[model samples]
Target: MRVLLAGGGTAGHTSPLLATAAVLAEAGDDITCLGTPKGLEVTLIPEAGFPLELVPPVPLPRRPNADLVRLPANLRRTVKATLGVIDRVRPDVVVGFGGYVSVPAYLAARRRKLPIVVHEGNALPGVANKLGARLTTHVAVSFPDTDLRGATYTGLPIRRQIADLDRDALRDEGRRYFGLDADRPTILVTGGSQGARRINTTMAAASRDLAAAGVQVLHAAGRPEEVELDRRAGDPPYVVERYIDRIDLAYAAADLVVCRSGANTVTEVAAVGLPAVFVPLPIGNGEQALNAHPVVGAGGGLLVEDAAFTPAWVDSAVVPLVTSPERLAHMSRAASGIVRRDAAEQLAQLIHRAAQERR
Candidate 1:
């Protein structure tokens, strides 16, 4: 099979795109990607060893403005560029995860009458996927309640490492690797690849309290020097790092997690069976909060506002929870129950069905 997958900018879009691409590649499919030079896909797609076709990003501005006035011409130019790429790649099917570049790719694929698969990762569909879904019957979504036409609840496709993770089996090695005490309850704190300033600061502030309660913290602070732990002597329970390359290890070591509620994060955490205190990004379409809803509503996790996720809340709520092994175990079971582990395979089958239709 030959495929052209489109998505970029944020990790939320790119992660699922790559997850599906990996599955297709394993089945001997030739995969190509469409993205913009400015987007993260420039680095990520190539690193995954797939051919990436670059296109100019055409962003549809909100509200009436000069940019909105230029939308038609910009969209036309991008669609034309995308058409050229489509002609050369001649993919049997095009799969798109919502992003700025996806709009043109979807439009071009629609014009070519190619099978187009649209994956919306958020509980609320984005404009690009929403537009694309109007033209195709293959629409896959992460959350069950996503309002999209012809949508299938495929869940979020996480990386292979996350999908295959065995936290109980890897706990000792993961804790030892991170210099955390194996006997103590460990909490992993992260704000994603770029990091969340609010989450970082709050986690740092709560580290001392976390240590005092005989709990260990593995904090991924994100930036170069965002978190600096002050330890008097021996190994403090709180360990801080700028970023974590091996998040599987983090998941293995963590009994609980404190992080943002992006679709990828929520899905990954739940997949690993780690109960989480989700702090959704305050800005943007309120999708982050919605992304956490199903998991939290399922008794798998707890959702808190960014502003309310203070050190005091950590002392009051988090400390109590982690100390209670029975409660943590119950929540862990709930979290794991919410994951559809076959999501990557499910999406791969959808792509295969769509691609097969062209033949």
Candidate 2:
């Protein structure tokens, strides 16, 4: 099968796009990704070894009347550009992962009457997927309660390593790889690939407490310069790196995770059974909080608003939680079964089914 998959910008969109692409590639499908030049997609997509086609981005503006007035023309031009790519690729199916790029892909695919599969990675559908969902009966969602027309619950697609990780088996090796003590409690703190300013500051402020409690912190500070730790020469390891390319190993090394609740992070953490303190990004459609809800509701994780995740909260809530092995074990068990590990495969099958039925 030939497919055109669309999404871009942050890891939230690109990570799932790559996960689904991996599954499709395994099935011998010809996959062409649609993205704008601006985004992680420019590097991530090509590095993943898939052919990517660029279309002009047609961003949806929150500003009323001004940019909104020009939206129709902007959308039309991008849709035309997207159609040009679609025409050349001649895909049997078009799968959209909800971003500005997806809007153009959806519009073009709809214009050509092609089979369209829409995947909503957040608890709430984004603008592109919301419109795409209206054009197709085949819509998939990461969270169960995502309010869209005929959306199926097929949890977010995650990396294969994360899906197949044996955290218990890899614990010792992962610790040694990161130069952490084998028996010390570990917390993996990340704020996606670019890092969160608030998370960086708050965690940096609480570094002393975390280190003093005999806890090992693997901080994936996207901005490494922002993370200032005041640990003594012999305190429990407080390793800071800009970003962890080997996230699977990091998961193996962690007993708990403190990170943003972007759909991808929440889904991956839940899939790997890593108990988490999810600090939702304090922006956008409030979907980050909603994305963490099912796992949090299932007793798998704790959700704190971004503003509330301070050093004091870390001292009072997080330090105690990390130190408690029994609670961490229970939380890990609860987090494990919350998200499906075969989400990428599920989405791959759905895409193939849509193509077969329409073709």
When summed lDDT is taken over every stretch of 10 residues in candidate 1, the lowest stretch is: 227-236
Which clashing pairs does model 1 show? Answer: none
lDDT of 2: 0.92
Per-model TM-score on C-alpha atoms: 0.97, 0.98
Top-TM-score candidate index: 2
lDDT of each: 0.90, 0.92
TM for candidate 1 is 0.97
List of clashing residue pairs for candidate 2: none
Error of 2 at 92 (Å): 0.3
Compose the digit string of candidate 1's lDDT tens values, residues 223-279. 736665555545457877877988999999999999999999999999989999999
lDDT of each residue in 1-359, candidate 2, tens digit only: 99999999878899999999999999999999999989899999999999999977777997787679889999899999999998999999999998889998988998898999999999988888989999999999998888989989888999899999999999998999888899998999999999988889898899889888988899999999999877688888888999898899999999999999999999999999999999998888899999999999999999999889899999999999999999999999999989999999999999999999665
